[model samples]
Target chain A: MIPFEHIMILSAAIFLLGLIGLFVRKDALTLLVCMGLLIMAVGVLWIAVAKSFGEMLGQGVVLAIIATAFVQGCVGVMLILKLQVHKPSLQVKQFTELKG
Target chain B: MRVELFYLIAILCLFFSLGAVFSTKVVTSLFCFLGCVLTVTLLFVLLQASAIAVIYMLLFCLLVSIYWVTAIVFLPKPNKNAYSKHFLHVGVFLLLGGWLLFVLLPFLQVPAFSPAEIDHGFGSARHLVNVLFGPLRHLWYALLALILAFLISVPVLIRDNTKCGDLS
Candidate 1:
């Protein structure tokens, strides 16, 4: 079995990648994708720690997170599609005028 | 041997995730993201979370990827020049941030891996069900209610937005 520390480091790296992607990407779809990556990283961390502790709760939480992520991904895509339909663009900069 | 395999899988996941983040085309990035998910699933399997691995395979690899592909198919072709100009700056900052996290996290005294005796039913569906319905039952109900609320409200919200000419 792999060490928990290594798994934590790997997940952290992936999480950071997602964070950077969230900031660096310009498209709403890409931002949503980055969010998915961030969610996955957290799930991985949870599982790793839980496994190390020999507990089943982490697996259960990860399962719940997976379901939640699926729903979020679908809803996010729908919203992005709606925005695209209105503006014909997925660029994040295009939607900055919603201060009202 | 398992550690080496874990390292290999971890490296693959990292590489593909970077590709997913940095690839120029949306389709390419999505494919890379799929690859990253696949690698992570494999890592989960290695870590003895077979159920989580399977769930991820189903949700991320199958469901999410399909949804993304369909969305991409309907989306107008993305602008090729849509990337931010500050790539180097962002990359450097993220690297520094990650390093800082790595350095500081060990102080938290998170438990290290000390392999417990393998329970044959550890990640089985029965175990998951018991855990969910046993001690974590309240959480399960809350999550279910949240999901139901989201599902029920989204259409109404969208319809109202459209009627109000806010989401045209």
Candidate 2:
């Protein structure tokens, strides 16, 4: 049996990885992926806790989160595409302005 | 969860996430992310998500594959330099992780429960409905409505922005 703490460690490690990517990556798409990983890490914790406590609410919460993330990815990709259209670069440094 | 299988999936997932973060090629990183996502899906299954949740996860995979196609076809190549390889950035990020770990250390205990108790059916679809529509049902509906409004308004907003020639 996998203990809860082991799963905690796993989720924390994933969260740290995602947070590092979030801070270190200057590309927008990588940032999006890191952000997704961060959110997924949270979902991991939720599922772990729910399992430990024998509750089903966590799965429901995760389902809603997945739905939101799906739409978020679509919108984020569109914005990235628009940014690509406006400028040939995906550098975070260049997007300081809200203009085309 | 089975210990051997759990550790294997967890280790593989960690490695894939690292690869995604550190890979030089955009496609390489994206593919690593694909592997990472799949491993996470395994973790989800190991944790006993409902069948419906598994279906949702497959959709998530589909979305990622679409991202892969879009990245391969549309995104520019000059942005490769944007990946920061600086040790200072990495060190600082590690410190952030350490601080969070220090803060959360107290709550990281392995609670006492037999494996069977942990496997007690926890993540079914019926419970999912109860969670979303049970208590605070009004609040849930309100939140849903707000999300719906946001989704509906986005295309129109984009159309107006494009019409006005302001991509912001």
Candidate 3:
């Protein structure tokens, strides 16, 4: 089995990648994809801790997260589609109507 | 072998994740996301959560299908600027966060570091079902209801937005 520290490092690294992408990317789909990466990282952290304690709660939480991700993904797609209808650019900055 | 597999999966997962965030073509990015999720499922399996891995694979199929069909079929090609030139902004956040992590890592108290002995059924489907229907019944069941609530709310939200004629 892999050491727990390795899992921790992987999760943290992935989370950092996602965070950087979220801040630095412009396309709406890529931003949402970055969010997915962040969610995956958190799920990994949860599972790692749960596995350490031999508890099933981690996996259960991950399941709930998967459900949440699906719903959010659908909603994201819907919003993206709607945004496209009004302004056709994938650049998030173009949809500045939401901005104050 | 397991350790090697873990490292390999970790690298592939990260690479695909990067691709998902940086690929200019929206369809390719969606494919990269699918690859990243699949690699994560492999990581889950390697972590001895085969049950979660299986369920994850099924859900991921559903999720990726939505992304692929919508992004590839419905949407036009995204602009080539998949990445932004906001380096100064990104750098400030990264530097501050990194400094905080550096300053705090030494003081983090990770007590009792030894992992417990795991059983064969530790994260098995049977184990999950038992726990979901048993001790964790309330939490997981509530989660199901929460998902259902989201399912119900999204359509209503879109309809409301359409009728109100404003982006509230």
TM-score of every candidate: 0.71, 0.70, 0.72
Docking class of 2: acceptable
Give the best candidate by DockQ: 3
True contacts kept of each: 0.62, 0.48, 0.66
Q: What is the C-alpha lDDT profile of model 1 across A33-91, one tens digit per residue? A: 78889998999999898889999888887987998998898888877766765677767
DockQ of each: 0.53, 0.46, 0.56
Ranking by DockQ: 3, 1, 2
Clashing pairs in 2: none
Top-TM-score structure, candidate number: 3
Give candidate 2's root-mean-square deviation (CA, Å): 11.3
Ranked candidates (TM-score, high to low): 3, 1, 2
Candidate 2 has an interface RMSD (Å) of: 1.8
Residue B149 displacement in candidate 3 (angstroms) = 10
* lDDT of each candidate versus the true structure: 0.73, 0.70, 0.74
Q: How many angstroms is residue A91 displaced in model 2 relative to the true structure, after the best TM-score fit? A: 2.5
DockQ metric, candidate 1: 0.53
lDDT of 3 by residue, A55-95 (tens): 88788889889889878988998888877677776788888
User: Looking at candidate 3, what is the lDDT of residue A83?
Assistant: 75
lDDT digits (tens) for residues B1-168 of candidate 2: 267778988999899989887776666677677678767775775676644345555766666665665565454456423332332343366458546744663353322222332334445555556666787599888988999999999998777735555656
